[model samples]
Target chain A: MSTDTAEKYHKHTPAPIDCNNVVISLRNIRKSFGSLEVLKGVDLDVCKGENVVVLGRSGSGKSVLIKIIAALLRPDEGTVRVLGKEIDQLDARELQELRSKIGFSFQGSALYDGMTVRANLEFPLVRNQRKLTRQEVDKAIRQVLDDVGLSRTIDQMPAELSGGQKKRIGIARTLILHPEIMLYDEPTAGLDPVTSVEINDLINDVQQRYNTSAVIITHDLTCAKATGERLVILSEGKFLRQGSFEEVFHNDDPIIKDFYNYNFISDS
Target chain B: MKVFFLRIYDIYQFSLRFWKEAFLPPYEYKEVFNQFFEVGIKSLSIISLTGFITGLVFTKQSRSSLAEFGATSWLPSLMAIALLRALAPLVTALIIAGKVGSNIGAEIGSMRVTEQIEAMEVSSTNPFKFLVVSRVLATTCIVPVLAIYMGFIGLLGAFVNVYNNEQTSFVSFFQEAFMKITFLDLFTLVLKSAIYGYTIGMAGCFNGYYADQGTVGVGRAANTAVVVSMFLIFIEEMLIVTLINTYR
Candidate 1:
């Protein structure tokens, strides 16, 4: 961390932390499409203001697990609870209501291709909270855009943005609702290494500033190390190993070591 | 043939899920307006412009056949009847199935394949309400309006063609043309347009929502959505015509 950034962190008192307050919990979750079981009997818990990252190979269902936590996909079996409310049982209306409190960043920079950057950021805010005046919404939009370092691109469309810029705008749009938990799917995918570092820094800064927990899914080991305090490797449909980043990194178990060393390991 | 049947079954399931997602809503108005502007208005000029030329060219080609029987005076009524009954709605819908329907399918299919839809799910926003319902409702509500616009333009095109070919005042032409059209005929036209709109919207959304595999899956969804919806529209039109004639 830079001295300038460290000083800023020291200057601002961190938000109140509820170490034991579980904001999100998933129990024995399972999902399958046809005969392919993507996630099988997975369990996870995220505390308030925690940064938890799921790491795995491309198809190990790390992303699927996060999606289930977000309540986007229904589990074939088990329960997911967000903000202490069980989500899987909720009807569509209730699900939408729950979504406003959670910010999600898509892997592909899923900004509406035709909408301007400002308009893209304004989408969830305008839809969920219609009571905000145009000025109020604009003010918030400017703040979030500035935070993501894309204020100058407000008038530009998604097609005009670079990959890094698109991801920033996607993050800004995610912040529109001031969600309690930020969900990121491969936030740094396809970016240059320098841009990837910048995005990782931004993720860290946002988590501290907003005091929100994060559930990040990524295959990039650099990103996993840079952004996460807690790391877990997902293998098959279950968590193969999980611990603090340093612990997971230093562990010498065959699967963990093989995963770190990039050795192919067949299912035994 | 087996794949086609499986696809039909899949589309049926997709439509049911879409409907369930649509009404149970925290609605996403931005996506709705975005789709409406694209699918309904952006495609308008093409549909109307094509309808107009089709009407004019039909008149030019059929004129000789009518004159051979000395039925020239019946041309106005015949044009009006044809435009209102089937040609306008059927042709306009086929064009939309190719244009707007495929666009919807591809857009949503790409979202699905890329895991963007999954992102929306984890963020607490119901992807169905935000993505699927918005496009479906927008298309359903706007297609009928497009049909009406196309029907009017087609009549105007026929008028210009008739005037260029033979001297006839606007008042006389409308008087003769409208004489044969009853409230029933107009209602039937509107009803068919509404059904076409529903079917087109449903098919496009279904294809996109359930699109699996990868890039190839999205392409197939879009292609199949257009072809199947077009076929269904024609089949339904023929069936409606038979039912109407049988009752008469």
Candidate 2:
């Protein structure tokens, strides 16, 4: 994949990883909120440069799973290792260090409302990598905005942008850090169909361009189908199946059939 | 009742976390200055107006009583003692508790509900240090300064009343006012204002940081921040006055 943004911005090579090496590994993860068991013994892994999409309905604990992987939430029972370090064992400073290499794109885009697009993108870079000069920061911001195709919205606040534009900027903000892994929570949750497709294309574009491993959590079938190199269906706090989109859905189980019917019916 | 106690305990824990994070390096100086601008500069007009009105009204009301006793000459000294020792700091704090407290609550609450806090965390930015510490430190540092300003403005308002009634000169009015005010009174004013500022900042940050249930949570956070800060401010005022009185 040709990365015009990477070439135009300051060029630096990412640390090499074997293509088959797993960057994110989760085993027997369990989480509960009060009386509700949100995630019950789940396990998953993603190799370097792979886009693994976890498809689940609302309240299926897909978000919890990702948060655990990011160490935002502690698992009740499990081991979560990201980029070769055990997430739970790392102290605050170590966790922060680890998190710098992982970019999380929130469900609502989560751009800072008080900041302009440029400041929003600059925030992570300036905070995490404090040595970058002003010109370097501006150049990187321009490159990511260009990559996300919203260079014109640099001066606008998050509220001024359309939903699609906000999503692009959110991705662009995460990409600015040059993360080794991207965790996207519902990248196309509330956009129009056309916009959803555009976001899916952007997700794929980011994966190819940045060569970052990713875990995309969403129930949107089109998004899963379009961006997921491997797809897993999360149901009742556990993964029901994992494979290619077609393989996962090709089942006689009532649950799988129901999921397919619901999505297909809704899409149609 | 159990839930209430739990909430208090949570707030206590949250305050401890703030102290721990506050001393850590990478101090977010830019954000602290921004919050100072927000808390101090933006709030100047309202604080000034409130201070002036308080001084004017309190003096006006007290004048009839003083005249009844033929002690009208004591008005400047009495007004000075009242405004500097109590009214200025308490009223300024309550106003700020309402204004800046609610703002911090709603802003951080909205950020919490929308996952912007989580976004900050994932980006390797300490959201608590960036958001809570900066606002709390700003309020802690600025509220004392504001209270002192209010005290001065209130005296000016009292002077206006004194001048109108007795043709007193500005210097004489001020001299009379300061006659009864001890260094202890000034110290109490500063201490009380700082405590109230800390209370307001902590209440707002705690409610907002832990806000839930989406938009409704944001509104609740803002409302709770004001009520709790005001309640705590009153309690703090009473305790500090009691303690300072013993010293006198």
Candidate 3:
């Protein structure tokens, strides 16, 4: 293939790897603190190029499940595999190597207050791939900044930006690594409706552009509707329901229906 | 009391895990270096500036008392020995433990409370390695450097005081100080200062790493770490004095 064609394919149409290419899989995962069982045998899967949304009320182990998948929290029992590598079995070095392929957008934006937006974007980039020439780093910065539509504010300190701009910068920083999978924890939590939609659309655009899988943890049904192809709901550390958006909306369970209807109007 | 014991256990376990994670690597050198810059180098000016003023003030105070005893000539040597042997390192470390310790505690505590540390974990980054190790290592290595720097500046301040107060020439003042100052005493001073640095840095970073209850918790950690480290430095200095007296 010509370089241009390869670049085009890389950006637009990645040769389908596998429709069921499970990017992340969790089986019989359990987590606890002292006597509190946080995640009770939670099982989940995100296929290649799928957007999986997890919904739950506060304290519902939705965030915990995502943490397990990302290898942030170790399960007291069971297995978590990402890209076919068992995460829990890997040592810290191996784990960091594995995490290089994953990008996480924090719920709070988590931009280092001491650093500017540009420096934050450059952080993982410089660490993971050290040989990128200065020009390449700058170009990568511009590209990711452009991707998140915050190129104009690249030099601004994180504190100088508005709430939505900070989120955009956070997303932009996550994109720098070109992760195979992107995990978002309450990406739209504190934003106004308009900015929330913009962030949701940005997540969608990233998925389509990179053919990346996503697992978004949120309580906002609107976010679930906009980003996830499949919706999974949790309660008391167990998977309460899981299906495609249509299957989930028409679910016989009143709890699921109530959640689906509640988000449908507010988001639309 | 049980809760108190549990908190101590929590801190001990955190330090243990931090060391294990930090040593096993794909080490985050950039983060460590960045923290070193923040915790060590950035805090240097205040420590040095304060040490200089402290030495000058001590000399001025000591001169008046010693003058009544007809021992005014001992001022330069006394100031040098006190600043070099004890005061500079102890004061700088207390200040550092207060300023940098609280800052790290707050930074890491907020990261924990906000789930930024969790975000790092899920991104496959070892939060301990990236956050805790880098911070501890930076403080361990950088605080010593700061101690040495502060000690030198404090000595210069003493020299300035002697030059102004007793109308002594720099050469005569230093000659007198050298006659009184032993190699063992200088060595002990450097050793104590380095120990003080390590103690302050480790305590501050450790408190921050395991901070609980959000911002209030971070504030408490920072405050407690400084106070505890300051107390420990004095106790350790006394213990060292006892050891040196017994051993020598």
Who wins the DockQ comparison? Answer: 2
lDDT of each: 0.80, 0.90, 0.78
Off by over 4 Å in 3: A1-19, A264-268, B1-45, B122-134, B141-165
Tens digits of per-residue lDDT for model 2, A22-134? 99999999999999999989999898988899999899999999899888899989899999999888999999999999999989999999999999999999999999999
TM-score of each: 0.86, 0.95, 0.87
How many clashes show up per model? 3, 0, 0
Candidate number of the best TM-score: 2
Ten-residue region with minimum lDDT total, candidate 2 chain B: B180-189
True contacts kept of each: 0.56, 1.00, 0.59
Ranking under DockQ, best-scoring first? 2, 1, 3
The per-model DockQ list reads 0.50, 0.94, 0.50
Over B85-158, each residue of candidate 1 has an lDDT whose tens digit, in order, gives 87888888888899988987898898888766765654445667777778778777777777777877887888
Interface RMSD of each: 2.7, 0.5, 2.2
